[model samples]
Target: MAQDPPVSDLTDDQAALELQRLALVLSQANQAYHRDDSPSIDDASYDQLKRRNAQIEQRFPHLKRSDSPSDQVGAKPKEGFGKIRHRQPMLSLANAFEVQEVEDFVARLKKFLNLAPQSHMRMTAEPKIDGLSLSIRYEKGQLIHAVTRGDGETGEEVTANALTIADIPKTLSGAPDVLEVRGEVYMTHADFAALNATQEQAGQKPFSNPRNAAAGSLRQLDAQVTKARPLLFFAYAWGDLSEPLAPSQSEAVARLQALGFSTNPLFITCDTPEELVSHYGAVELARSDLGYDIDGMVYKVDDLALQARLGFRATTPRWAIAHKFPAELAWTELLGIDIQVGRTGALSPVARLNPVTVGGVVVSNATLHNEDYIAGRDSKGDSIRGGKDIRVGDWVQIYRAGDVIPKIADVDLSRRPVDSAPFDFAEKLKQEGIEGKRAPGDAVWRYCGDEPLADLAIEALKHFVSRQAFDIEGLGAKQIEQFYHRGWIRTPVDIFTLKSRFGPGQLQQLCNLDGWGEKSAQKLFDGIDAKRSIELHRLIFALGIRHVGEGAAKLLANRFVTWEALSEAMQSAAPGSAAAAALVEIEGVGEVMAQSVVEPFQDPERFAALQLLLAQLQVSPAPQIDSSTSPVAGKTVVFTGTLTQMTRAEAKARAETLGAKVSGSVSAKTDILVAGAGAGSKAKKATQLGIETLDEEGWIALIEGL
Candidate 1:
């Protein structure tokens, strides 16, 4: 069997390739585990893959895939349950393992909010109970529906099942007009044991854990079955509230309790990092005795206003983090290493280990980091394992933490393979009939082989046809993959010329294919033709340059206006050149992004490809969206607080449509700051910075002429 090279041996190109493969595998596994209720892989292995994906993204943010699994919240809802779209997505929190990590979390939050390092930021630390996340919606003081946190965006409606749980109040006394109480639905250890015992007596399969018992019971198709199960709900947070609950996290929990919902008593407020850590230890010590399982403790910014300002990332919230207990470790035999090629032509090493149980899950593989790590060195090339290299057939320490990839901690020198030799990454690539060379000033090797280049081209083609880019209606990912494998669509330019090259009278009609009929084939060709006269922004985004998302593309399009202008601008924009600095001036387009845009255009092969693509279509000039007539045009505006006239999203969208640059922070450069009700620190900061501030009516009046 072919072995993966050690992570230490991986080139940047190889890591990117492996990340793409892992993204697909882990997404499928998540689907099976969360939606189908059938786990194809053990939790440890799944966590390992997710961890690897995250590591690669962090190292190569520019190459972060569009369909990145890291940005995904949860699996899609199963078919049996009715779907309910949440007004606000139930986001997951970032994790911290050590006290230092917890401290770092607080420090990072302080920096984001522009607070001094020593400034006390009040926070709440609560036991993160191991349970299913449930959201119960109440309207007009009566419970309307309840749902599972399926994929965060939309969830499976379990209103019937929820009504059976006595702990979930059916009617609230003084609740908001519209309230979506979100929290954990868990089974106590005593309840779980009794249920399992009853199941054993009844000849049914018993649940493996209390969490599984609670989830399985609550998700029962029959409401009566759910009623029979003892499940408890703890309301800790609110989702869609028509009116404000409280000003702080602690007060909100108290409000939920007063409104007739069970709240976790362990939830406590901490004014400092030391208090947070102390409360976390207290929760951990009392975990086993609490009658319920808790994997960690969660810390949230107490001030609701701060939480609003912090907002969210692509997936997790910025205002909160879960400080999990350290991962469990177990010794496993190092089977062998495998080399996985990535789309970007980097060769990555993966460690295959004999199956071992860690943290109640089976781990079959762990990350070896890189060549240095395999050679018993850390990322900085410092000796970590007494200079003893990790070899095949050696006993290795494996670790698995929540949502963290399993990693090899140390090697047992006593059990090292006698005949083992240092793995040569370059030699291995040659042995596999792949040609690649390490670049100057870079540790990772880049593949020079034709097959790897083809893989890169195939990825580009997929992005070119993606919804956010070219958006070829009839040609989806599956169809593109099939076409590429069969040598039909070799390049993105080939896509535009498909119908012309392979007309109806061709020797092999698309209709002759097993999956394609005459009508479908015609539709595919028509879809390809419809995209010939694409907008400048779409073409720029379709290029799939690193760090260049749709927003960045739009910014570039607005600045450059035409294909020629953009091409000239990129060609002239050398790193640290005034031309590059000009590109960065465009709101939201940073230096890293500007460099990615220019570097690809500078490559001869990529330049040739772009020329070919440009020749095959009509690229239009970027439209100026009524900029000349709008007062907000070319202005940097910040919207803060709550707007009763319109939502934060609606206001932002409107501002952008009127050619205004909507910024998240209040800086000295801000032309206008729109302050709504509850306007807090950002409003104060705007005043301190001497930036123009406007209320909702003032903003509306300014834009009324447009």
Candidate 2:
């Protein structure tokens, strides 16, 4: 086996090349695992690749590729399974590879909740079983459907196969009217062995692993085939609940048990991080004895309220993390390095490795991060590989943990080829316009183009027409790219004017395009025409202002009520002015976000673009609910202090649904004040103004009829 090259051993050019290769290989592996369920590489190999990819990315931060594996989630869903969109995305958990990382996870959670160092924070630890993820939804206490966790947002419907499992409950005795029980569908070791034996006897291809066997069985087209397989479900979590089952994570698991579903018994509640880690060790020790397979232990914050406050990242929850066991390592030869450009103009490097198996999977690539990583120094300039740089043709050590990308651990000095040289990314690209530079506060060296604004135009347009934005159907990324290249859709306004300026002549030209027919061309024009009118929040989001995400845009829209009002405010709001303060006062808007919202409007070119866009469309005002029959309908309600029955956000959402206007302040306009415990000056002001004040119970009573 060839040894892995150390970062110190490689030059900048070599590192960039390695990162590029790693990106391609990891992407392929992810697809194989998520879509095909037949991973070409083992868990250990994949982890090593990912770790190496991350390492290189960190070292050469500027050269990070757009298609860097770190940015992606699970693979795309297969077409065979009927696509079912999840009500709430089924997100993946962040991983903690080391004991220290687990400790850091706990510490981070504690800090997020503003807990004292000695705070008796409780956590629930459970075995992360290696099986197919299943979501069984129940309506009116009866099983309605089941689906696979495809790419978090959408999954394949496997209702029939799920019904065949004995451990899944067909009907719940005392469950919420609407419940989504998410868990793993797995076959026991004994059953898997027997099934494989039977398959071998029948001269059929046996499953590669227990996880594969379970996934394949549950995803079978014929329900009878799934029934023949001894599959069992261990309900571990609940989603999209109509009502609360319990207040904490541990109690929720108990509720799942009481509701006639099989819950994992090994999961235990611990008040401290020590206990969680200790329990993890015990579980790891007993892995051989467990009936089913578990790759690692998962630790989640016990308090549901805290979990809610911690919220979520782009793809993982802040309250939970999976602590994977030690990864396996193998050696492979460094064949070459490559680079690829990202949407943000970062040039990322990847490693192409000679085929080598590690932890049951073959790894052919890994990530090399950026300039410094390939130079054998940490992002902070600390010596790595004893200050040795990795070079092409050198042997390298690779490691993998779970489904993470494989990483190069170190290079074996003895096996490095004598004639190998350092890599220079700038020289490789050979373009004066493409220069390497670091982003603000970023340690990586990105290969930035001279004209970043032009590069940003294409990505900006893509976001502008996305579902959450303009939602122009039939105008997908490919179509937008083509139109941009053809000078037909350079800006948002161009999309609206396509028919008026170009008309049938352009439509005929579009029809003559390779991928377009008469029907498709008409459909494209119709899509553009249908979006002549748009909601205020969507329009604000479509502008793609920095830090102005969907949520932030909604807040701005609701606060201002109309596009004209917001544009006027932004136009007049000088930095540190009262207008700027008002913009910041809106819920969820802070100084940074307020500045991001303002700076774009200050730009003459962007402001003109906005004007042109407005001239070509009719933007609607923010949502207004009016229910004439309801007492609180159209009435301004202010919720103060802690809400006992539900979260404050939930209360506000419910109130809005009932056609009531929820306000942040208590004043003469506040018709009703829903005061919970510990109500302060707002409650006093409401009382002073003779505004109707109601406790949690009273408020519930008032809304009961409505």
Candidate 3:
């Protein structure tokens, strides 16, 4: 296992590598769990990996893979089972490992709904069953079909196997014309133990866990084999309901129970985070006593209307979250430390440990963070781990939070080897032929060699055509690398001129190259030609500037509107100038990022290259915001002081949704200022500038109807 740096700590090249690694690793894990009914990693590790992957994608949205794990739900349905398309997609829940995260979840819900802190909001907390999710459809009060939650949108039709579960209702007295009941199919501990005993007596391989036993039995090809296995269902949610089940989630579960379907008895409603956390603790206490397996407690907004308003993200519902149990920890001997260099030339330290089982997965590698961490200090020289440095032969405690990789928690000084000495991190780097110097205020040691690395250039080219960038079809990473090595393409500018350079009757023509025919070469040319008229955001991101990812590029495009405007602004954004101020005033752009954006334009050589690149194609302006009914459309608004109606984030988001540009600072160009309680300098500046000023209530009233 490889240790990964925090998303915030990763460089652009490192983030790209991490995305690739996660895509492959998560794909394998999904196959093992959904297809084979034998998970390669525990649920905690899987959730952690998913969480990390999502964090990285959120940080570097441009580098997100086309086959990103964040977008996938489950593995494809296994063969031999009739395929069924789910009427509604069955999404997974975001996870919360700490009480603070649960609180944050509640806070986010209130913020999204623009509700007061003291407002009454109920949430239902129920056990997250550790088994396979199944959707059973009932049409006209009769059972129609039963489908597994395969890849969210489609599933395996296991109607015959599902009918054997006594907990599932075959007929309903007063059900809707179309009712799709979704729940978990699980096996009780007692039944699983008995089944395992039977399997041993019959010389068959016993199942690993109750959840695996249930999934394997439910997915069995032979209906008789499934009938003989003990499987139970608990209905907690619904899909494709012709009529609403109930106004609230708790009521909906009750409605399912009334329909003769088995439901969890401990499901309860709570009004606050305290109550929710209390219920989660109670559930954890009762986990061992419960007959079936449950990984954690799931919290969902009780009011169905609120849930609908909250809606969903790419893969998880914004109205719900799973409060997972704490990570498991184990002690293992620290074997050695290895330094791995990323494509960005950043050196990362990984800890090798004697294989030990934490939770259910074997862990041999952990992240040491950096040299400072090994010296028992943080970047600020603050003492950590009681100022006890880690040694090579010490017994270290490792914990698996989300299983992308385990992390070292603590060092066991008492069990440290007498012969072991403090690890020489600097000497190790020198020994590995790494002679890079760490920049001031930067933790990472980057390669500062005079010559440019081929890997960096190739990675930049790959990023230019990444899914969220130019997204050139047929011209992928492999093609880009091959062309780069052959000296056919050196930079992004060369890609646009490729067709003209090697279309036909030219020395070293693309059609004459191996793996390239007339049709294939023409297809590649067409793909390149299609990107001649590109979106402003895509073109900006395709430039591959540091700190300018998809989100940042979109922000830049939205602010400037057109490529010519941005180009002119960047060229004239001198130090302390209005243009420079405006550049930093854009929300999410800081001094460092602004400098990165301005550096290329400031250099004559780079600016000349950019000009040449722009000359080869047409750059479209940013997408128009449909703010026909917005009172603040095309206006620059600033919020200062204490907001009573909503948080600053909500206010900003609302303003943006209404087509208003929310700037961080007030300037001569400022159109309006929304002042709240304890209004500060920005409000004063707005008043001095003779700009429109509105109190919180006034601002709210202005946009209330819309």
Candidate 4:
């Protein structure tokens, strides 16, 4: 198999070097295992390395050279059948061997997008079969070709031999007009046993493992010989389309089954983390019950929209995450704690360790979570939770929690070092100077400082004057923080009055502060004066009530869209007033957030100060939302290329807000092609059939007119 290019950040030569190394590693292992039957490395080791290579390729996208081996599939089709190209390029996933890695991956995913930590992820789980990869193509709802995954880019045609498998379709019923189905072809333990029994009676070579047996069977020179074996195809994924098919990932799998495809029924939808674990457990418990071979179960995010947002890494898609079943175990030491701070200041303790292999990965860390989680104490002290009890420097038995994370299963307390003691997280926090801002949840420390309110106010003010709101330059988070710390500002009102104290003439007084320079102070005053007039909705939101974040702020402001209207509404709804409850009825405002908004007005002193600040400010309201801007503005559009009108991301976000849906690999459902420069496969596909395609200029023109 060809290696994938390293991610874009890597130097071209560096990417090439990594690609060559990956190719050599995988090629050696492949030949040793498939041809010589003398494996150079175990499956876990091979899988882990491959996953690592895939990850590196995904991150440095600019390094993606067309010649990368990752573009090719490993299997060739048998000589008899005609081959069809996959509608969607089949990419593999980058993986993790431990909970910390998986959690870290999740955290990184969110951090890159500036999302909340507790933000829910939609994921799905399925069994990862240790079998030959196969793709089936259908057009006009008729069987076209069955091909092996050659290099992901090209494969040998194997339609004739694949046709012999009963589970596969020669012609599928209820299939969409055009479809490409992907799945694994495998020989089950029972099927392989029976086949091998027949082979033994005939004095032929029996296979070693089901994977080997299936691969050997599918690649046979004689179609008749392969026909004699009972091989099954369990469809997991497919792409290329004539029309839109399923709405969600789970729905798509279900539809695949309805189309005469032998899809795995173990695929289920789960909403919560605990529910997800239960679903994973159910699959694990039934590992032997299933007739076909599944080396591990795969969990993917359930939401297609979220999946689309997370898009594909070179090897795998972000929308979905995998949870593989346990395969092996490794022993390691829980060296010490490395606490990671989260965006919301949650403290999560990670174990620092001497790296050791478990499940083919050399895991050096695992989650310790919180102080309550250490010393065999849970948040509620119930058996220390997760059946995990281990201390720093203790010998720990680690196993793949579904081949996803290296979970500590046991601790040899007898092997604990003499220096080992109950880890005092408090002492560690004090040393780190993070004890004051202890994480809100389980044993964690934060840097909350002496005045949490001032810290929070600074965060709020930063948002208030942000580009999207007031567009105030020189009044960024740093200035807000500095002002709050220096006692120059307390609430949003203090900002409007600041120019009076630190005038252009008195800017000499402003200079000499750690970050302030004469030029910077003058720029700050100019910015403050320039933003003397802001949108009314933004002006109302600058007060920074407890629960009024961006979404809430927008909703509250838009409901009235001006400070005068908003204040009047608040006064009308004060306490038991019907007007206040009416304000609560606005979408997105719960009773708690609504109460927080209205109750702030009840504070006469605070309200009076806020009003005084407002008196000095000149603000106007936005024209109006015009309701058509709500996602699905009652129109449809398609997009392709390096969208000059906006980033493909920005265009898609706008489309979604206007109630438009984006599809990968265009189809008949596609409406308007907001094609940007350098449009490729999509524009080609759209044009061959006379599908309307727009150039960047045309898209810009259309949107401008809209």
Candidate 5:
């Protein structure tokens, strides 16, 4: 695999390619780790890839792919097990590699909630168990189902196996009518060692690690097999609750304990980032001493209400982050440097190192990052590695962090070969017969050819039929590439028209192809036909518009309701116009993203293609929020001034839950305004616009009833 450049250094096209690669890689990694109970990559490497993917998506929002890794959790349930769809998705947490990132997480929360810097906030810090995630649901104080966190939305039914675990309660006393306790199922060090010993004595293959052992044991098809395995569960969170667990996260954990579930004893509340970091350090220091394996510390907003207000991203909670432990480091000799071309044609330098052990993993290659990095400088031309450039046969200090790709941390100048000289990256590229030039303001030297554009087109088509998009089964990436080269499928619309164009008696029939037989070709056509009607969000994502990722697509779909409405809104949204303002106001869609969303509608060629595509398919309207009982549902609301009843953040969150669109500024579109004691310009504007007005007390009364 080629080394990824910094998120800031990637061009839009490069970012899109990176997203596609990450999506594919991470999806496979997830299936291996979560569903198969076998991880192909180490934790550090997996985390690094996930982090890099997220950073790239963040930097190039418009180029975010529909199958982005950030929006996915776990993998599909393994075969041979009955599937159970979770009422609430078992979401993964965002990660923080550094203490500063924890601070940033806290800062983002405050900013999102419109909280003052001095406002009091609390977060709960707890050890992140390195084990399988399990969700045990209880109904009417009785255990109904126990499932593995297969994919976020669905899982493998393991109720019979769960009954064998002593730590897991068979039933709950005085619990909510519906409660889903989510936690980690782990094996202690002693148990793992004993289990491995038993396996070896029984002439069976021993497990690789405690986490894997626990997962394999818990997921066994035979309940008797699982009953013999020593397993423990620690409840940390809940899903699909009929009633609130508690006022805060810490209290919720206690509630779980009271309800006959085991909870981690180290879980505690912290008031500041410093305190959280201190707890992380304490946990890291105690990791070896603890019987169970722990990878990091998880920090979440303590207040349950605040967490609800903060809400969730596509696959992670906005109110929480996992602070991972530091990476392991080692030294190695730089044998050679190899340049690999990426999907977008950028030449990336990879350092070939002597096979050395780093954190118990054999390392042979490391990411050189770019030419600047190889020259012992950063992108801004600042000195790195003490201004000593790397050379062949030089001893270097390497660190394996959250990536399988180790990186050179420092040069052992004292041990450098006297005859060695600084390796010229440009000269090496030339010697490799790669001709390219680095564009101004770009760090990467991309291939100066039209081949990359063709690659991009194929990639775009692949994304169009991706699992998260149209999800046309039997038409995978390989098929897409083959079809592209064969001139059978050129565009998304062409995919829907395949049956018509390549059916029986046509000049070119898919069934006539060497590899594709009648049944397979018919199945392919059926797959294409099955996707002729797609949901609004999936269709928007299938368009592959810059900045309009799956999450953003869903937001737009929900906001506009229908395809025609969205098309009209974007087409009418001129620069600096009120329509543009409204487009940007859709939460998570800012100015740059808003511009990207409008560009397709403005472009003559793109707009015509879009119309043609629409003609080939039926796009269902966005899923409507069930707020039929609320009078303010689907209304635009603005809040200004000091409310006596609730905080502004609470008010906004409440309104949104009732299907009201909350806006910062008052406009002609404002449906109603709630005037508080210190109501200002917004209130006046609302009154002038003839929008319905109400007092703070009246506002509370209007939304009080169910």
Candidate 6:
């Protein structure tokens, strides 16, 4: 048995003796496993040691330490993206890795909050998206900007690209004017697959995994690049708001939803950790069917007031915890190896496997990662149990780092016989993406070769016309998918032809089918026509490019002035490669967005067809700016309280058209302060400073003429 670390409490002699008894053994074993990529025992045996350490500490509870190796986080934070200064510091959660850990987490919360064991404390469990953290800012129902978690103090601005996420609401229903919402920006399995396929086709390197994809999407310098990537979000936190929020965590989320923020749907209120874990299991099973990737479950205490009282640690909050799922691990046959290039232009190896289910989803391949991962071994220099020079028929174990790509874990040596020959990856590519549809040079990692691709195409079309994409009210995703599958529609134009495509005879046949009707079909066509007069920005956005988002499209439209100008700029093959070079030369157009923009235009047939479709619609030049000579022009203003003179809507509308940035809070940066009856926080904040404050009459006088 390895020696155990001593408790932190007094009785130095005993403590030192205990640490000495276990120091070298425990540290060596841990180093071998975590750092050196070697394991002294199987997972079960390793768990036994940890359990023993836990038992010893339990007997000496006072000696328990926070910095114990048992409680450390995996991998340090990566260096990139600027930091963000959160109004409240974003913190890491204490974990509930296993069922027992979950029970303990609940027990600790109950004890800390002075509750009965069976007390009905409402808790919420949300999927912990295994991706980058982002904060989105909105003013008057319109998206203004977005940022990364950068240092948790200041993040790089990437709003132009954030507009591309299909699921994120571009125009939140009843959106608050001053809203700062935080969410995890992630990539879906389908998006990742398509993106990697394109990358492979162009001989560009793919992402290491989906988490990296999400990170890359949010960290782009140009919003357009961010827009082109198929990123997704689920609001989990909030910053400054126009109004105070509900008392409970669940209610706050509900309030967010009421204000048009997209919150994750899997959130639940639980009284105990067991129930929390039950929810976790339910969600884990559903991951295979969900739109984005998630690795753990987040549990938050319900009461906001209680949460404030509990407050936060420097890095994480005391009111919440993250319970990680059982990591994905499976043993399968290592049939061969293949090499793949990455976005960063690095080469990697992928393990091809006999299809096997890991964590309930069928995985037929695993990432070999860098050359080091394939060639390196653990302490004692033993071969990595899984596939260090794996033979053609060797059985290997694969583990997903989070819930994304599969990686080699270890091998079952006892099952291996001496007759197997070493596997070669380069040769596997000649056979891959054929029946299985694995692409060439995809040796470092492979996706499901036999995944029903037809269904994916349908899914893609559904994504294209989704609410965020085109906001075509009448057509639903399932309907689009069905239409595509039935060969009724092929392009965006096909969506317009749905009603015309289905003849009355076919319509009558469809009416006999479920969820189909003459009225519904007619409504769909009307909806399609209603969107015919698409705006310049929205039309550019609906094309479903990888990262060309609404904000970027808007910027591009504004800069280029017209569809012909923009299209002409994109199509020019002038010296310095006018179109491509110009795109890449644009301040925000980095390699990724430049490539994405260039590729779509590169297809002459598709470009010609798109241009023809665009020619049909009456695209707006820009939103009509209301004529205003209002008093608040060029000033930053925040509105508070009920307005008696003018309606709140009237005041905001008048203020917006006058070219003012209407903010939410009474920050030091605020210039003009408009106070009304029943004003509270804003009034107090205004009073703290000698900034000129206006009552209802004064405010009325300022905007009376305009």
lDDT of 6 by residue, 1-706 (tens): 3332334432433432243223333544544433322344433344444555555466665655554434432222234434344554444466556788777777777888898988877788899876777778777878877766654555556666677777666766665667788888777777888887765433244665566677766666666877778877778887777865677889888887776667888888987777888899998877756766666789998988878777776556778888776666667888777655332223356788999756434689887764335554443446564435555577888775334567777766677768865443434444544222234433233334444345445554665565556777656655665666668766777776567667777778756556557776667678788878777767776776656765566555555656766777776734367566766654334666656665556688778768667765777775434435546778887877656445554465456656677777888888877765346667777878766777655666776655
Runs of candidate 3 with Cα error greater than 4 angstroms are: 1-132, 136-143, 147-324, 330-346, 351-367, 390-395, 400-406, 419-425, 471-490, 493-532, 576-578, 585-588, 608-617, 624-629, 633-706
Q: What ranges in model 4 sit over 4 Å off?
A: 1-22, 30-41, 51-83, 108-115, 326-706
Q: How many pairs collide in each candidate, listed in order?
A: 21, 70, 2, 48, 5, 38
The digit string of per-residue lDDT tens for model 4 on 1-706 reads 2343325555544454455556655766665554443456656667766775666677766665464546533433335445556557666665555545556666666675577888866666677777788888888867788767754655556777888999987887777788888898887767877887666433244665667788778777678988988888889888677765676788888888887888777777765455566766676666655665555556666766666677876656765555655565566777778666543345567888788644323468877666666667667667653544566778877665333545666677678888767777767777765644553553455556554444345666776666666666667656666678877877667777887766554466568665568677778778878888877656655655656655566566556767777777776676667886787666557787878787656779768976787787887874453436453355456676554224554455445544556555677766666665335577667767677776655555555455
The deviation in Å at residue 306 for candidate 1 is: 0.7
Tens digits of per-residue lDDT, candidate 5, 29-95, equal 8998999888888787788889888788778888887778878889999998999999999999888
Worst 10 residues of 4 by lDDT: 1-10
Candidate structures ordered by TM-score, highest first? 3, 5, 1, 2, 6, 4
- Worst 10 contiguous positions by lDDT, candidate 2: 1-10
TM-score of each: 0.48, 0.47, 0.50, 0.42, 0.49, 0.44
What global local distance difference test value does model 3 have? 0.84
Best by TM-score: 3
Candidate number that wins on TM-score, 4 or 6: 6
What TM-score should be assigned to candidate 5? Answer: 0.49
User: For model 4, what is the C-alpha lDDT against the true structure?
Assistant: 0.65
Clashes of 2: 70
Q: Give the per-residue lDDT digits (tens) of candidate 2, residues 1-706.
A: 0244765565564565566667767888887887788887866577778888777888888878888887777777888778989999898888888888888888888888888878888899999988888899999988999988887888889999899899998888888999999999987877888998777433245776678889889888899999999998899997799998899999999999999988888999999888988999898776656877787899999999999999998778999999886665777899988765544456677889998755444579988887678879897889888888888898999976555677888999899888888877667566434566767666555655555544457877888998799888678666777889888888889999887888677778887876578777678778888899999989989988867777777777777879889888999899878999888766567897888789768889878988898998999998754556667778899998666466675577557656788999987888999877446678779879999887766788887755
CA shift of 704, model 3, Å: 13
The runs of at least 3 residues in candidate 5 whose Cα sits more than 4 Å from the true structure, single-residue gaps closed, are: 328-706
TM-score of 6: 0.44
Q: All candidates' lDDT scores?
A: 0.80, 0.80, 0.84, 0.65, 0.82, 0.64
Residue 248 of model 6: what lDDT? Answer: 89
